[model samples]
Target: MLTYYPGKTFLHRLDPTLKVLFAFTISTACFVFANIFVLLGILLFEFLLALSCGLWKWGLRSILGLLKLCALLFVIQILTYGDGDVLLRLYGDWVITFEGAEIGLILTLRITASALPLALMLRVTKPTALANSLYRYLHIPYKYAFAFGMAMRFIPIFAEEMAEIMEAQTARGVELDTRSFFKKIRLLMPLCVPLLLSSVRKIETATISAELRGFGLRKRK
Candidate 1:
């Protein structure tokens, strides 16, 4: 499924440079503030922006994915270097410090709070528009920017293809998850071989077609 949703919301109407700057400003502010209230306000702002853009569902999905990363960092922080007064004394001398836990919680919250607005901007904007904006306002090289834009457009297709490959393998009784870690990785060899071979052939065909069409004979203005 495509992660992007096309819409005519205010966010979509805004200049891509401004939208990018807006996300960067919020992210920077979130990193600078240690106060949880300020961070919460940032989160609220992100939610409001997403809602206003009419991408509430898409934004929520992105937020949920972000939450997973936040949870991982929280767990790692709680488990390591937990110092100061013990909140709950677990087995052994391990102690979950109030300061450490508080810092961890704030860090995790800041991460999710910061990620939402960026995700909203990316989800609402088209890659071509974003690249064109960068080339215009940011003075990025047009060829490089367009290539990056094309790469971004291919991400969803690659993800979908991966999912289909996994499902097809599962249907064919490939034990993808039941093997040892190394074995599971080795099993990927079969998948990668075919995908790489097909990709190489496709790339060759595309290159030949472009050469015949005189793609680079004249520099594009």
Candidate 2:
């Protein structure tokens, strides 16, 4: 959803090369720092950064798409991580420990911190600008820089294709919605097959379009 928002804010005016470096630096730091307090500060800093760039609302809203997956991941971490004091007892040999819960929260924060700034950068920077900046500032091959831009452009396209596929299946009364989470997961499994085929078709179409446009043959100047 954050596929170039087009604003004249400070971040939008900043050079794409610097923006890429900033995002990479912050995203990488989320993984490198092991302390929960540091992670929280990173997330807090991201929120401030978003506010400063005039992208607080849109940036946060865009990240909502990852919530479901993040929630699942958080749950998995809590279930698997067994250490520290026992916080709760669910059944025989199954308990939620303080360490597990802490770890889960830490991981969830890390992911959120990592994605927030990158998403804001996407909202501010255009793909063409990114490609140009990479080639000029980093001396990356023109084709590879262009490919990176195209890859960013493809994200929302892929998500759109996925939604359309789901809608099409729903029209056929596939009972894709279920109250049970695991049942919903099973229902989504069928969508992957169609999504993969659709992805291949789209990639093929994109390849043909790129070839016709002389994607790799274009000059830097």
Candidate 3:
């Protein structure tokens, strides 16, 4: 779940704006250096920080998908940026260069390091506190802040709904776990229809509720 977990940890006690600043600073600073060692250090720091907040397990689980994505990006970078000292030569001049691999590794680490801090913040900090901090400290409009928080809160809900839908379909004799990648994609495509319809219905209901509460017309000082 992306929603905050109530805790008495130091991270939970931190001001939302300070947490946002720390995440933003680390994420941005990660790109300022191209060194793999520095990126690794940042990644280590993130891991330690997550552990400090008692979120190491959740952080690892959350980042598994991201790790796969980073791996894919690393492969792409290695293939596309192969213009340096040859490390391993493949068939027909397809060479894996040392420089390319180094760059790919650094990029992957940087991306992962950049994402972890913000993910940790979202996991530990309440959405209402985040939104209020954004409105008060960052001067962002309260309506926009509320929408952002709601979107974050809804992500896990939508994911759970989709999983339930898939399970229901599987129970009804639908084969969704085929080994063939394309077949899996084809099977999954139909599931999106129901998810989209449900999302639209939810949006309609939320909009009507907000309107009833005069959410847009309320005056702010």
Report, for every candidate in turn, its global Cα lDDT versus the true structure: 0.79, 0.83, 0.86
Better of 1 and 3 by TM-score: 3
Per-residue lDDT of candidate 3, residues 1-221 (tens digit): 57787898999999999999999999998999899888878887888888888888877775675777799899988887769999888767888899999999988888888988888889889888899999999999989998988888778888999999989988898887667867877888989999999988987898799889888886768
- Model 2 compared with the native: what TM-score? 0.80
Compared with the true structure, what per-residue lDDT tens digits does model 1 show for residues 121-143?
77788988999899889988776
Query: Is candidate 1 or 2 superior in lDDT?
Result: 2
What is the lDDT for 4 in model 1? 63
Q: Which regions of candidate 2 deviate over 4 angstroms? A: 62-68, 89-95, 177-181, 192-194, 218-221
**Deviation (Å) of 38 in candidate 2:** 2.6
Per-residue CA lDDT of model 2 for 1-221, tens digit only, reads 66777778888899999998999999999999978999879887887877887777865665565555588888998888777799988788888899998888878888888888788788789998999899999999987887888888888888998888878887888776557868767888978998899778987898899899876776757
Model 1 lDDT at residue 165: 79
Top candidate, metric TM-score: 3
Summing lDDT over every window of 10 consecutive residues in candidate 1, give the lowest-scoring window: 194-203
Against the hidden reference, what TM-scores do the models get?
0.83, 0.80, 0.93
